[model samples]
Target: MKIVKVFLVLSVLLSITGCSPLVNNNPTKVETSSNGSYKALLFVNGMELQSVGHTANESELVVGEFIGAVNEKVDIEIRPSDELTSNYLEEGTEIYSVEGNTKIVLAKKENGDYEVFE
Candidate 1:
């Protein structure tokens, strides 16, 4: 009947509108360190990760591993190579090493951005 056709058309239109992807208007801000000479170590779920070193100009560490979920937290420590080795004190966990640089700490924000520290 005519009523059935009208209901069906409305349902289809509603479904199509509801299927649109979400848009985030307020984007998250990225944090960067001021020190030009610093080193960072990235850790995910307490496991050290091998990542490309981020310079003072770069705000975020470039990670090769795939982060499965959004807003996943990562811990970063900026310290001397010797101190890190001494503190961690674990074999085969030393992923990257930098010499003659100050250490800094970084944490992942809830919005999936790195919060840089001095």
Candidate 2:
């Protein structure tokens, strides 16, 4: 009986330690573009796809393979004005726009040099 109690106590301890606590049950906060400039090409499946933020205004975007190539052409538009459009950028990644003044979070990965899920 003592051995069984010890085993059960160990099992309970293991169960308690094995699980992670849940936090931040709230929805994610939306990050707004500073100066209406878009950042980071939406890299999905290893390609630069198009996306837009809701608050994005006449905001400009940089589209290129390398960071330097963005301005090799013209600025791209983040159309439709909706955060859903940019859900692909993920959260926490830093991005710069065509003019290079404003910075925003990638918030997701659409494509680019990084590997992604289909």
The whole-model lDDT of each prediction reads 0.36, 0.36
Residue 95 displacement (Å), model 2: 8.9
Worst 10 residues of 1 by lDDT: 80-89
- Models 1 onward score TM values of 0.23, 0.28
TM match of model 1 to true structure? 0.23
Q: For model 1, what is the alpha-carbon lDDT of residue 18?
A: 81
Itemize residue pairs with steric clashes in candidate 2. 43-110, 43-111, 44-110, 44-111, 89-106, 89-107, 89-108, 90-107, 90-108, 91-107
- Write model 2 residue lDDT over 1-118, tens digit each, in one string: 9999999999998887677354323223323367775442343223344444332223333332323212122223332233223333434443333334223322222433231111
Give me the runs in candidate 1 sitting further than 4 Å from their true place. Answer: 23-118
